[model samples]
Target: MTQPVSKTSVLAGMTSRALVIAALVVIVAACLPMVLSSYQVGLATEVLIFGVLAMSIDILAGFAGRTSLGHGAIFGVSTYVVVYATGQAGLSPWAGFALGVLAATAVASVFALLAVRTSGVYFPLLTLALGMIVWGVCLRWTQVTGGENGMRADVRPAALMSHSAFYWAVLAGAVVVSFAMWRFVRSPFGLTLRGIRDSESRMRSLGYNVPLHLFIGFTVSGIFAGIAGGLYAMFNNFVSPSTVALAQSVEGVLMMIAGGVGTLFGAFVGAAAIIVLENIVSSYTERWLMVLGITFVLIMIFAPEGIIGKLRAITSRKVR
Candidate 1:
């Protein structure tokens, strides 16, 4: 009894839906600080921070088809750099920010020297080892990272002295980074990466430097992870081994998978879902992790591609 949807009509519908979603997000951002409690707003800020981290991992795992378990090291390293730059060296917050991100990029590039040659389980294993090495450093290097106690590094500028102000800054950062990522994933370079993901040998036969492309993508992903880390350092005003732990790396991967792999917007969705449960559900029960694990299993059973992927599937079905 239903009419078939033409391709033109489906395209128009998708565009309209995207515009509505964008407008709604803008409205929420504008109203959040005024409506939410300080603690809630701070939690939201954390979501955005982790969203950036998850999105970075998504770029490689989703688009480039390379799963990395060492992202937390890259993230934690940046945070420590920012902390050291501002807290220990007495550098300006802005300068510390730059150095923090640069350090993360450098570390990721260095790791890529060994990782770029491998794929599949080998790449993840190498990255895991690299991550563990960084984690050990953060733990053993007491003078630099303050070991278990951690060092409180205040990197807030005069303009962002208040929590609300900092939240706005974070919101702006998330927006800019998300827009840039969205553009990058649609660009010719992104298309080439996808081609490599689909058929590495074919791309290589076409004279594409497959390893070089993957390496560059890996480094670029680290850049965003570093930015998230820098923001996290300033936001938390602290640095420690926990930031670089293997658990945090696993969390990033879980977020990406929960939201929807290969979809940038899904990264934020996944972060929100996970962070909300951590903050809210943990308050009610001590076994929140178990509950979360159960939820993840159910989601995978019903919607393996994730919430966004499932939604896309439904939309596609409707269009058909």
Candidate 2:
């Protein structure tokens, strides 16, 4: 009754769909500055930063199958690096960004070295404990981090002062980072990581150093998280201990899970959804966290694999 589709036809359809989506994203992003207010552009910047953080989580959780609960600590360390280097040390913002990345990478390597030795729940708990220690240091280290008052950048860089420039910069950074991550997921190392994720014992038996691979992945993810944190601190011109709180780490996990754990685009979608919902719901009451928790539970019960995953499943069924 129906004509069967060939492999060529399916490939062509996928390519065409991807192209259309790419074009749409470009068009929308290009037009947003013209249509939206500067405040809205600022909000978009926050979304992009959160998207980066979410993607970092995806790198570990989705690809490497490593559940980390201390990513917010890495992010906070970067933020503090930027603030301390640029604001207090009187270095250039660019130098601050580099230092932030270095700091995050160093911390991540140490964390991975210790955390990767364990698997499952212990790994996450170890990271969480480490993150809390970092938070405690930030809170108590008054001379360096400004304690509860937080640290502020003396000035915003010239390039980021303009709303349009900042918007474009953030958008470009997000796109480039996302593309790099996508490529990483398609590489040999990425395939090996997936293999490790599926069965670490099997990978070890195959002569792969599982801990080494995880450590590398963790460090890479931390570098990206640091970059995101640098952008966030620059945009806000402030860094605080609260930025590295356990709650923030939990939020990152939630964003990745809600978006679609293994899908790259899902991170962006989840960040956008969470940001928009938070903004709207907070306008009504301070109990938005309660609402958010309930909503998350509902989604977990109804769409465990997430919105994108559910859509993909539906599409596959239709094709079948």
Candidate 3:
């Protein structure tokens, strides 16, 4: 009585569905500033910045299988570089951004070279130590960084005109970075990285340079994080040691885990959820970190695969 769906038809349907969803997202974001306050738009911009940071973490943790607990250091270093170059050295903001990315990438390469020698918990601890060292430098080096008082910048370039314009700029950056990351993960190099993740011994047996691949991945991820950090500094017109704290590193990990380890959409969702929840919780009490900790624990225990992964599982089961 009814015709079955052909493979081509099914694929087209899925593609159409994705386009519809993407269109809806853009429409909503474009209209949000009209209905929301400037403060709300500013908060949304922060969430987008975190989304970029989370995606960088995902590239290492999900694709390269290298879990870094020190991304906040890289992030902080980038922000400081931007502030120092533009604010102190009198370079253009664009030049400062490029230099920041280069610095972060170079640092990541060195760190990865040392870190790739270790594995599992040792790698994470190594990164944690690196992060703490950076934090200490930021705190103790008061002259350049302004120490605990932090550093501030003037307004961003004219491209970012209003609060809404800045929000859109951040969102556009997030989308571009996300797309590039998605493409990287779907490439042959990405497959090789996955091979390393699955089995370093096997990859080496096949004559693949496992450590080299990881180092490259780490460096690339750091560059992306640097871009996010530079944008954050510009958006807020400030940077501080607190921005690179251990808590911020943990937040990046939490965003990745909460969204779905290997899924790109998961990172965005997790960033949004965490930021929204933080804003709400902090309004009621200063001890909001306690609530966030408990929430993370519960999410780990109950929704271990994350919202996106779980949704996929449900959809797959239904289709079957």
Candidate 4:
């Protein structure tokens, strides 16, 4: 008779599988420098940066059951802060980065304070209104923000000025953000967030602080989004109102939905797919937006659970 596998064996197998996947990713990122052009590398770096942003949205929509349509404002505000500190104030890159992230976190905390009072659609609308306030400041305060023309500043230190050097730095930051978020979502706090997401009433009856947990989750997510903004400003050496626009917010939502909300891995996958479709496909076709729309529709229709969710379903079946 064939022996059945033990639970320990299954756990060990899963652990090994995860390690192998991580190794493969590292190897691929390492080798890209050899084959990819400078521009291509920059583009790839952008995908990773935006992947961090998408994951932030996932933390809210996926884990907390709170969706914000104005998340781009948080990202943009941080970027602007970094740019101002570095260019206008002559602060060091590291200092600028610190200030930028903290500022974003502060902004997020303020928003969360009020947003947590509301639920469902109201939360998102409140966020949207608040975000528009930031945009208005950026636009009207031309003397400081440069208004519509935007501001240009080199945020990279001399050592990281090279394309490859900057890409590696960004890659490191992205990796840290990804690992930190992964650990967080698997923690007790993350579990609490999930309970709230599933049913706030049930969690409240259990004596859980539902609003508090959601506010914390939202604030934490904003920090990561801020980090992405910092990297983006450094990468492009430009900060503008465009980064905080409604269109950018919509794109972030689209990314989370496409990748499988709640899956950190799915967020990155979705970012890659959307960035590739937008950047690569647009080079050859004038109707890239239409193509992207079609792709999104198809994914929603055929794989509503998202790429990662579908894969998990397959893996579970095979294991069983």
**lDDT tens readout by residue for model 3, 1-320:** 01111222343343667655655675676677889999899888888888888889889899878879888888878888888888888888889888877877777777788888888889899988988888999999999999999988763777786899888777777766776777678788989988988999999999998888888888888888888888877887788898888878888888888898888657878888889889999999888779878987987887878777777889999999
Cα RMSD for predicted model 1? 6.3
Instruction: Give the whole-model CA lDDT for all candidates, comma-separated.
Output: 0.85, 0.83, 0.81, 0.83
Ranking, TM-score, top scorer first: 2, 3, 1, 4
Best by TM-score: 2
* Clash pairs detected, candidate 1: none
Q: Model 3, clash count?
A: 0
lDDT, candidate 3, at 42: 86
Question: Worst lDDT window (10 residues) for model 1?
Answer: 1-10
Return whichever of 3 and 4 wins on lDDT: 4
- Quality of model 4 by C-alpha lDDT: 0.83
Model 2: lDDT of residue 77: 92
TM values, all candidates:
0.89, 0.90, 0.89, 0.88
Model 1 lDDT tens row, 1-320:
01111222343343666655665685577478899999988988898899999999999888888889999999999999999999999999999999999999999998887888998889889999999999998899897788888788778788997878888888878877776676677777888889988998999999999999888988988999999999999889888888998878878887888899898878989999889988778898998668767876888789879778888999999999
RMSD of 3: 5.9
Model 2 residue 279 lDDT score: 84
Alpha-carbon shift of residue 171 in model 3 (angstroms) = 1.6
For residues 290-320, write the lDDT of model 4, one tens digit per residue.
Answer: 8866876887788778777778889999999
RMSD of each: 6.3, 6.1, 5.9, 6.1
